[model samples]
Target: MKLQLRYLLVFAFLCFFSVSFAQRKKEIPQTTRLLFVLDASGSMNSAWEGDTRINIARQILSDMIDSIANVPYVEVAMRVYGHQYNFKQKNCQDSKLEVAFGSRNNNQIRTMLDGLQPKGTTPIAYSLEQATKDFPNDGKDTRNVIVMITDGIEACDGDPCAISRGLQQKGIFLKPFIVGMGIEPKYAKGFECMGRFFNAKSSRQFKGFLQEVVKQTLGKTTVTVELLDERNQPREANVHMAFIDQATDKARYNIVHFRDKGGKTDELDIDAIPTYDLIVYTTPPVLKKNVEIIGGRHNVIKVATPQGQLNIVQNGSLDYSTGHSAIVQKQGNHEILVNQQVNEPHNYLIGNYRVEVLTRPTTVFENVRVNQGKTTTLNVKRPGVVTILNKLSGYGSIYVVKSDGSEDWVMNLPEKGIPRTNFALQPGRYRFVFRSSEANDSSYSKSVFFNLSEGGAFTLDILRL
Candidate 1:
């Protein structure tokens, strides 16, 4: 009796522990919502690949629902278009959600498909527009997916591409997986921008395509950003990374290195797809386009963004100018990169650049190379400061003529009082011409030539001249 009691107690304790562990290991409930937009137009009744297109679609879609029936936390919905009115009825808005999103909806979807018949004209775009209302937007972490099966293009003069784009923008759906049954390759461009369009000429191809779509919609992949250094080695850290979906041009993942989690760069979990653009924020932004992330695989992307610094060195001191500016342009094509007032040092990528200083005669420095991890100093010759004291008490205009015979109007001196005008002239030979007018009288002019050098300040009294 004692041995039997001890055995019973041990069995009970083991059973309790097993049950507790199982409960702890259970997966969290993540919602994966799928909506099927089927084409039940008159064209689907035509015979194709040894059976009607609608019949083949019904069989394949039913099989797909059955395959995912036991998938936990998944909800499925169905919408059929053009099955309500006759082909000549002109009913473009004949679309209905036969079964709303619900768990274990395989039987409901199959029953609805069995009763569907090809009747009205094709309204592909209108049907897609109505599909936005089929999914719930409760702000849960649900993967909203739309699988559109159709045999023809939009005959209702509506833009399906624009609708799909809007739906993806609203976060109501992913890029709709379009399966074109018995569609010509030439017309495939119509649905190219709608989503990942697959041209299936037969039922077998359609089945494979559907399977692939399901796998992609349900799987997740890993993405690692390999920041490359000067030697093209993956050693850079503290980079801001963004993964944008190329199909929708939407940012799906954004993270900053060394800041998100104790300066550690971990792999990112992303939806398994082929069209992602990886952008790494560095000195000059780095972009890697058309990145493919396959299921059950680790994707490592190497981004090379070697950078250097630009230090503007003023050779001489002249405090006459309030702001200094330069324009950095690409060497060959002269594409402007930086413009406006730039006084401090800044970092740039490793490339040849041309610096155009916004001064008298516009000084230009060409073929300036920014080495990796090093600073390139540009020694610029400072201009001379010239101050003119107009004691004649009249309105006057100052002009500086260059050696090449070109002249620039410097400033206009007022006539009310003894006014002063200043000019920051480049270090060269310049002819200064001044025109003055006495109270309501004709004007008189005078010209003077001066050799200006770096850091030189000259003051001229017009009355004495």
Candidate 2:
């Protein structure tokens, strides 16, 4: 019995170990993968701050990697360009990933950095495009980052800004960190749209910038989007807000504006590296430009988006079967802003607008004012139906008899076939002229004048004319 019990306990331990191992494998911690795209072009051999640009970049970056080597849930990789061919070769496709992202890859990257030689032309755009593939698909949440170190603009005549923007739009990496090594001011403008431009005039500045960028990459940054009313109070809610990168002009975050029970906007975590342009999806979208958020903290962004309700309704009727709506446009502006359905309420920025109901005759109201925190109600007259009954199919025309003794053509009946037709028209006076297909001459045509009243129906008949 003792030997049997020993075997049972051993089997139980094995089962427990298997279950625990499976659970451990399923839990993947989020990681931050930083890829360094270093420039080893011929210009990097030039002197900056009493040392070659490549040397200063290499030593500071190597020390920095050593400091971050032990951080949990973080990985690093290095890609170098202009290190393969001589400057005379002018190789534009000379970029390669030296030390791919892996565990404890600091020693590998440091060794690779120390051995890099600046002998070829700069391929900034090509290097960035290749670095996108350096991140591994680990089936876990990962934030891919890039830090590009360059001393000169693209000598290979490639557009780095466009490449960086394209990669960001594809979610390949976050906004990159560009460390410029004493580049000329005129040429520095070219890098403005590349990423967060950091000018490292000396090795000291480069080291400090490196530390800041890494710290921000691992930090938790948040923002509170506060939409203000005319009273400058946070009262608006349930609108869409887009956080766009100012450099790329692409939307990085699109979120529905939310508020808590206390009517306060909630905080949102966002990337601290890229500057943003906030677009509030109001009736006419309001643009708040150059929105920057602080790192490692909660930021409050306030924009005045005062709004009011617009309710278009039909008096004495509620018929959704008509499927009609009003075209809303700003006064003196022909652009249609919203096609608001009848009996429905919509919100728009407080302003004057023109509302044109799509009912027959098209009732139009100008200078319709929407005040702050108030509702503007437009009541339209319910339509009247005009039914025509004929003995035979015929060609006919309907005209609106204006009060000024002028007539406006409204509609035309079928040339032949159906003997019945209907028109939903606003309350007005109209004249219907009809000729039966059996009529021998035009003089046999019959004309009738009738009045259509609101919420009433009128029928016209032709006696085989």
Best by lDDT, which number? 2
Judge candidate 1 against the unseen true structure and give its global Cα lDDT, from 0 to 1: 0.80
> In candidate 2, which residue ranges exceed 4 Å CA deviation?
1-30, 41-55, 84-94, 114-121, 137-141, 169-171, 244-252, 273-277, 288-295, 316-321, 414-423
Residue range 141-252, candidate 1, lDDT tens digits: 7878888999998889999988888878776677788999989888898998888888897799999999988887775667677776689876567667888877568788
What is the lDDT for 371 in model 1?
A: 88
Q: Spell out the clash pairs found in candidate 1.
A: 258-263, 394-415
Model 1 compared with the native: what TM-score? 0.69
Relative to the true structure, how large is the alpha-carbon lDDT of every model?
0.80, 0.86
List clashing residue pairs in candidate 2. Answer: none
Candidate 1 weakest ten by summed lDDT: 257-266
Per-prediction count of colliding residue pairs?
2, 0
Residues 399-447, model 2: lDDT tens digits:
8889897988877877764657677888889888987777799997888
